[model samples]
Target: MKDNLVDNNAYTYYHTVWQNGDVAPGTHYLDVTANDKFEGIVKVYVTRRYDADNDHVKAFAIAGANDGSEFEKVADVELPNAVKAGKAEAEFTIAEGKSYSKLRFTVTSTTLERGYWHMAEFQLRPMTLNADCKNATYPEAFAAITKALEEANKAVGSVSVEDIAALQNAYDEYKKAINPETGIDAIGVETLRNNAVYDLQGRRVQNIGKGVYIVDGKKIVR
Candidate 1:
């Protein structure tokens, strides 16, 4: 993917880069795992091959995500004064401590003369994280949580009631163990059982109505 950008090859005829024949809005996704190492900044390169009749991309919105499933908008670029012909490039700095492995670019309201959207190159350059600040503990915990959430999400339709309750209980316990400021575990299971309510999946709740819930990690139907 990195070579495609620096090679100076115009992707006008074929689908070398991401190009669409239709003028409608389209979204393009790119995985930047090879370039991103919890980086702090990302540089984007967009090369336009030809421009006639004022045909060009209007507005583009960029979004990033750690896990490909969910994405958050990172940058919004508007070309009010359309470019005639040339390469358009921009550099975006990520949040102080945040990083993303995947990026999505959506182009909206493009003007096409030949009924095609042309993009010669789309490249990403991510800044490397410092070696001294690298920590594996947080990432391991995050991976475990992500895996649990993925399993919960996959069990939406096929899981049994008991299975759901067990999964929820596990999640609640995990949350309690990780939350340093909450100190939920210090409150004692007996007190939590008396005060808190559990949802059908065994998650603890407050002020819940008539339904299945979990108290002290035990499932109860109310």
Candidate 2:
């Protein structure tokens, strides 16, 4: 069940820093539904990709749902060229200041390369902080995140990526303020759901342990 493909169940947050990439294009229309939801713009990131043409988004559309019912078409968006991280983003606003629980969309790549569309990693999000915090485990900490999210979404004129990133940092800081655990912070929880291999000790093990390890969100014992 694990390969160099994007699995809606397994695909999660990845690094934005330039590094050797494992991104590969799918053979079909790339449609994904976010586990969390936010208002404002949506962005995707592709790192270390060799072809630019394969990264183009053909048709982009968004749907939102608050009650987990059928997602109503909220916007037919036009994408903007990414200012950073070989990314592509679409700006959309939810009506009536609604926060959706299901944010679903379809992204078709403009071109196909050797059956690979080079969608790279859809890794752009400063949205994690915007999830409702009223009933959260750490309401006090997440309230700060909510405030940051509010400023970013309601800002006058256009909100820059830097401004959005500041919100993300606030999310990270508040997560720490709440103190989820003694070890790693909750910020890396998304990164944990990836294709990398790790051993029993929680140490990332590479180029070894072909079996008896975890990769692509699956247990391999071959």
Candidate 3:
């Protein structure tokens, strides 16, 4: 039995690097929670290809963790045919259920005369028992939005009359359940735009000429 887990039931990663993106290498972090029954082999499967000549480098690796820290390299493999035929990959294991942060891959080759290697995609998957539906906390998901609103309020205090009207209209529509899916909370955008007065002809009434005019965290011109 293991204490860590990898859930790969949702999405798959893919890539194809051509002349424009001749080479690519990076890392990705995923947040997941453990199930009541936490024990399985964390599996990472990578599908990649090199598109070059005399390119000598092709490989992929996987690492695992228990609490997103203290990572350990568990799986590593070299693609023998990739250097010659430009195709190779491997799968490896790690403990599952905790949280693995750094799962990465590196490819080094010289194909297409770019002096750098070209790759398709290096992907990773974690094996799990099943029943994993962990999601983000409300505060965690709204952190960026809250931060933006705070910055906007610092620049411009209070919502304007026009914004208040818009908010009311939106709220009325929401209350009536008209197009229930359409209305986003007008609390943010309305507050900012309301402060700025505009003429009936749709021109900015404020004499905001030349210099920068920051409205609701966005810059505007005269």
Candidate 4:
């Protein structure tokens, strides 16, 4: 497929045998949700079951298709051959002035072909550039309101654990500090307690072992 500014990569594996299967023996479909797209030079790696003599299909190539019917070759050369059994790493470049959405691998006859080849271990990652981050466009006025809230919070210090239960009051005080005339901010005071100490859902928990209980999403060491 064509490469663009957005770096995306993915993996595909034909674990099932062709010909004997319902689909044809040539092309198969792959899900890209697990792997992302590619932006520039992508490392193509695969592990296959079959090999052709010494010249066995050491490497493979990529073809892009928008509708899955007609296909066009993207890379000129086949990926480097994998001498080992499981993985082969071949670098393929996304050509300039072109972008691709979908790609597939075409398997030519290799030397050792008893059954069809079984392939796996695919990867595509960005090498040239990072993706862009756009600013949130909804709130032109909310920017100033947020800035005032930050300044007011800086004037206040951290709340202690004993007073942690009173965290809801902090939001009210900040709202009042910003708008002295109207106390409406205090009307809808909401408190956010990080229950992750006992729960494990909202935050990313790490360093957990077996037989642990996850509460709310956090791992509780048993």
* Candidate topping TM-score: 1
- lDDT, model 3: 0.36
| Per-residue lDDT over 98-151 for candidate 1, one digit per residue giving the tens place of the 0 to 100 score | 667776666654555222234545656453435542223344444454455556
lDDT by residue (tens digit), candidate 4, 1-222: 222101111122335445543433234333332133444666655543233222224434566655445666776435455543334556777776544566655544344422233553444544344344111231332344344433433333443443322333443344444453342322222211333322111222332222222344222332
Best by lDDT: 1
Better of 3 and 4 by TM-score: 4
The deviation in Å at residue 67 for candidate 1 is: 3.4
User: lDDT for every model?
Assistant: 0.51, 0.47, 0.36, 0.40
- What range of 10 consecutive residues in model 3 has the weakest lDDT sum? 1-10
Question: Candidate 1: lDDT of 212?
Answer: 43
- Candidate 2 lDDT score at position 193: 81
Candidate 1 lDDT (Cα, 0 to 1): 0.51
Q: What overall lDDT, based on C-alpha atoms, would model 2 receive against the true structure?
A: 0.47
Q: Residue 205: error of model 3 in Å?
A: 45
User: For candidate 3, what is the TM-score?
Assistant: 0.30
Select the stronger candidate by TM-score from 1 and 2. Answer: 1
Model 2 poorest ten-residue lDDT run = 1-10
Error of 1 at 31 (Å): 5.0
